[model samples]
Target: MDKLDKQSRTIKFFRERIPAFACIPGCHDCCGPVLASSVEMARLPRKSEQEQDAALAALSCPHLGAGGCQVYEERPLVCRLFGTTPRLACPNGKRPAVMVAPALEQRVYRYFEQVRHVLV
Candidate 1:
């Protein structure tokens, strides 16, 4: 496979492997500024420079809506990792019944290191 195809598969692998858990109703405490790979960003709605600056200044995610994450389904791997790993535990103490395996988490981090990431 080409580089693009490999990266795409890697992204899909992590997305599917990451476990999901119940979050506190109406809670978005973990929504904040985060870095996303170009591949991930392409899946999200565009935000203007002004909007990006404003959200960064406030230390909030540009995609965080009044209700919750506006792009929850398309959120980056880091966003999905939140509350799923011990390192990024949910503020409300919510987590999957089984935490992400250390090896898997490290592999995700390694992927992040290999990719070009930008603030989202």
Candidate 2:
């Protein structure tokens, strides 16, 4: 498969295997200062300068909408994997019944690195 096809498959598998719980109502504390690849950032909708400033000042993601994430479907793997990994568990104490397998997590990490490396 081509790179795009591989990326799609990887993301699909990762999302399916790594479950996420509902975040606390009206809480976006974890949305701040997230690191994402260029491809992931490109998928997100642009934010206004004022909105960007506010998000930066508040240390939150610029794409964090009033209701929730503005680009939920297109959100990066980091966003999708949030609250699933042990090191990045949800602050609200919500957790999935099955955690992502170590091998699967390693694959996801490889995907991230590959995407970033290819873009850069």
Candidate 3:
């Protein structure tokens, strides 16, 4: 397969490996400016530069809506990683029943290091 396909598969693999959990009602404490791979960003809805700047200035994510993450289903891997690992624990003390293993977390980080990421 080509590079894009490989990256997509790697991302899918990581996404599936990470555990999921419920968050405290109306909590978005972890939503903020974060780096996402270019492939990941392409999956999300486009936002204007002005919107991005405004959100960054407020220390928030441009896709974060009043209710919650507007593009939650297509959120970046880093966004999905939040509250699923000890290193990125949820402020509300919520997490998956089984946190991501250190080995797997490190692998994900390595993937991040290898990929071209852009602030979103």
Candidate 4:
């Protein structure tokens, strides 16, 4: 497969393998400036400087909205992996009981390496 295809499949793998948990409702303590590949950031809508400043002031992600992540569907792998791994545990203590499978976790890291160069 090509790089694009591999990236897409890797994203799908992450989505399927990573466990999900219910974070504290309306609590965006974990949302903030995130380092992500240009490809991933391109999937999200751009934010104005004012909005970015506001989000930074509030200690929340620029994409965060009243309900939750405004760009959740296309959220980056880092966001998807949040609360699923011990290394990046949820600050709000909403981690899932079962962690991601070791093999899958390794694959996630591998993919991160592949994209790390392009990450901003």
TM-score of each: 0.97, 0.76, 0.97, 0.78
Residue 100, candidate 3: how far off, in angstroms? 0.4
Model 4 stretches with alpha carbons more than 4 Å out: 48-59, 117-120
At residue 75, candidate 3 shows an lDDT of 90
Instruction: Tell how far residue 86 is off in model 4, in angstroms.
Output: 1.3
lDDT of all the models against the reference?
0.92, 0.72, 0.90, 0.76
Residue 79 deviation, candidate 4, in Å? 1.1
Q: Please say which candidate is ahead in TM-score: 2 or 4.
A: 4
What TM-score does prediction 2 earn? 0.76
Positional deviation of residue 14's Cα in model 2 after best superposition, in angstroms: 1.4
Instruction: Name the TM-score of candidate 4.
Output: 0.78
Candidate 2 at 83: error in angstroms? Answer: 1.0
Writing each residue's lDDT as its tens digit, candidate 2 over 24-83 gives 788766677566665556567766778777877878877777888777788778877777
Residues 13-109 of candidate 3: C-alpha lDDT, one tens digit per residue? 9989998899887788999999998788889888999999999999999999989989888899898899988799888899999999889899999
- Ordered by lDDT, highest first, the candidates read 1, 3, 4, 2
RMSD of each: 0.8, 3.3, 0.8, 2.6
Model 2, position 72: C-alpha lDDT score:
77
lDDT of 1 at 112: 91
